[model samples]
Target: MTEPVVIGSERSEVGLPAAMEILLSGGSALDAVETALRRCEDNLEDHYVGTGGLPNARGEVELDASIMIGSSRAFGAVAALKGYPNPISVARAVLEKLPQHALLVGEGAAFFAQECGFATADLLTDEARRLWREALGPSVESVEGENTAAGAGDEAYRAASLELVRRLAPHDGPWGTINVLALDRSGELVVGVSTSGYPYKYPGRVGDSAIAGAGNYCDLRYGGAACTGRGELSMRAIGARAVVERLALGDDPESACAAMLTDAATLPDEFRAELRTLALTFDGRHGGAAGQVGSVYALMTATSAEPEFRARRVV
Candidate 1:
């Protein structure tokens, strides 16, 4: 039996302990991944995911999440999902109940979540609304017309969202999805990621977090990988899947993660920004890396008292 382990983003500090509980109890990686991410989603202070996350220019909290099972390479993802606090659970449900589809977005994803008996909540917290209001300034009043923010197809809202998308550095921070990757006692590998995406982004702009092989990938034969930071870099490089492919071809954890960033660097400078990754092998080896220096990730084992912060290699 392989030793159980959990690895994730820096913000996953809110989740590691809960995930460890599931792993130490001899639970499956799938369960651990879901539990970990759900815990993070409930952290109202994080402001980068779930309830307190920053909103799009229209002042909406659109979320994205994905889950993958290594053994069978099963995958499910949702993008631009509003009103759901635990998108990871919804993603997992999609994996189990809709194997024929790989992704769901917008109204379809929300409808499916309702079918799954998931409760809807106002994902926007007071803090999030404050941030959105501060970010939008006076223009928010004009952009948020009488029509509901969700249903507003007014040209003013569209133009405002586009303007915000153009002016802001899409990757203003080094943060992205909270990736929760777990290796179960039975040796199964599962990777999950959740995020509200770039702050004040264009409405309906889906990032890498919602794409399986881009932001996350897994295969029991090798392991699993997840990306954070700049989601576009992962999407462009197919970073998560590339990391797993390298591991399958005999690369070490560190080298595999570094190569994933290198693959991302091949993108034209205009398209590139920050990209970070966490990798775990089926045999239990793990590491993290980033396109920028001084970045860090979190790791915890069944025997660990707490998650360890590791400096990510700059590649």
Candidate 2:
């Protein structure tokens, strides 16, 4: 029997442990990811995800979240919602409620989150307040620039590009993305992704975190993945799922991930930016693994022959 596997951004005092809890409880990938992200929502780092993410220029906390189930090709997503601490749950709700393939922004999404039993409190916390204050002064322009792009050239790229600026505005410290890939005890393949909106972002803009195959993807017959780093860069580039597709073609997870990064470098200047990282985990014929999560964006994999996880950095 293939052993169950779980992979995520890093071992946060909250996220990693939450994943373990789900795994230990015999939960599937869906449960694992939901549990992990929920834990993150409650932790001090809550500023980046759930209800605590930075608002878009309008000063609203619009959130985005998506989930993919490999077996059914059933995907769910929610964009630009406030009052929902865990947008993933709301995304799942959208998929379950609709007869079609997708959903979009506004009260429809927020109404859905409320129906799913989500609770909301004042989003700004003491930690986040301090973060914003400390980033005041010269950093203010950078932060505000990310929040609003009134002069931003075009509408098509406005939302995503603004998020990138917001993510980069805070030079306060480096942060990690939360990712998880796993096959449940029942043998279902699931992928989950969650992140706070970019820092200093306008209140309502949604990042790649809510986009499937960009932030994360899963294939029961093949493998699964999740990513971290600059969402705009990864989303426009289709980085994480591309790596998994390579693995399906018999490339080991490590090589497949490297291949994806290599291809990104060839893209024209219109696509290059600060390096984003991808953390992929799969239940290979060999076993489960936690991919590389590093500064320069990396990938990792595991196979049945060697259950141990291996990682390699890619620029």
Candidate 3:
């Protein structure tokens, strides 16, 4: 049997080493993928996810995550969850414990995590809070061509803050996420994703990170795929699923990802420039692509001693 391999989104270096350790020790693909995502989720230095996530306009942190086991086509997801730092683990629990359902959202997801004994914590960090405050300052919004301040005790300011968040949130700008894919020696594939969603988003807003076909998709017969960047664009394009479907149609992993990225480039400029994807085949072949120039992904194989950061071919 061939050794296992793992691939991840641009920042996966943060967790890829640990994931490779588990794979080298003969862990299951699902286990390795989950462990890697958990590491990223706990990393306080990463403001895009978990403990250091940026808050919503209301100054509350909400998280989204998903996991998929290719062999069984089983999926689990949580959206708009508050106080849970490791939503990837919560998603795995939802997959294992809740056989009939694939997704949970909001308070229901939080309640489910509590039932599963997941630890809860405030996900917002000081740095993220400071950024949120800065984004909501007096210059945040303009109404009727008049600059409005988001200062305290001002109704216009409050409305301006909300509008600013609405426009800039939900996968705009330089937001980030983690997408990890693993192929075990036994040929089983598992893909997982975790994100804080768009920084300073509205409360209760859920992005593609928690959606199965949008942010992630896997099939042992074909491969697996996961996406980052603008969640709305991915959701609209069915980004990850499109890549896997192309692989299913006999395209190599690289071609599959590049083709999807090319398609993404045709979207409106806002969504097009920020799109990115990573893919892995059942046989351990992997690749990535982006709609904008200079994007990259991380790769780790059984033959490699460390993860390699490779630049993506922009479409």
Give TM-scores for every candidate, taking all chains together and pairing residue i with residue i: 0.93, 0.76, 0.91
lDDT of 2 at 38: 70
Scored by lDDT, the top model is 1
Q: For residue 94, give model 1's deviation from the true position in Å.
A: 0.5
Q: Model 3, 1-315: lDDT tens per residue?
A: 757899998777888988888888888899999999999888887878899888877778999999999999999999999999999999999999997999999999999999999888878888777777676764543323546654554676667677776566433344588999998877789999999988887788888899998899999989999999888888888999999999999998879998887776667754233778889998888888886677878888877888888877777
lDDT of 2 by residue, 145-257 (tens): 45654555445345655555544464445454555555666667776666666665665656667777777777776676666655666676787678678768887665666
User: Between candidates 1 and 3, which one is better according to TM-score?
Assistant: 1
CA lDDT, candidate 2, residue 83: 68
Q: Ranking under lDDT, best-scoring first?
A: 1, 3, 2
**Distance (Å) between predicted and true CA of 250, model 1?**
1.4
Clashes per candidate, residues 3 or more apart or on different chains = 0, 14, 0
Q: What is the lDDT of residue 303 in candidate 1?
A: 77
TM-score (C-alpha) between model 1 and the true structure: 0.93
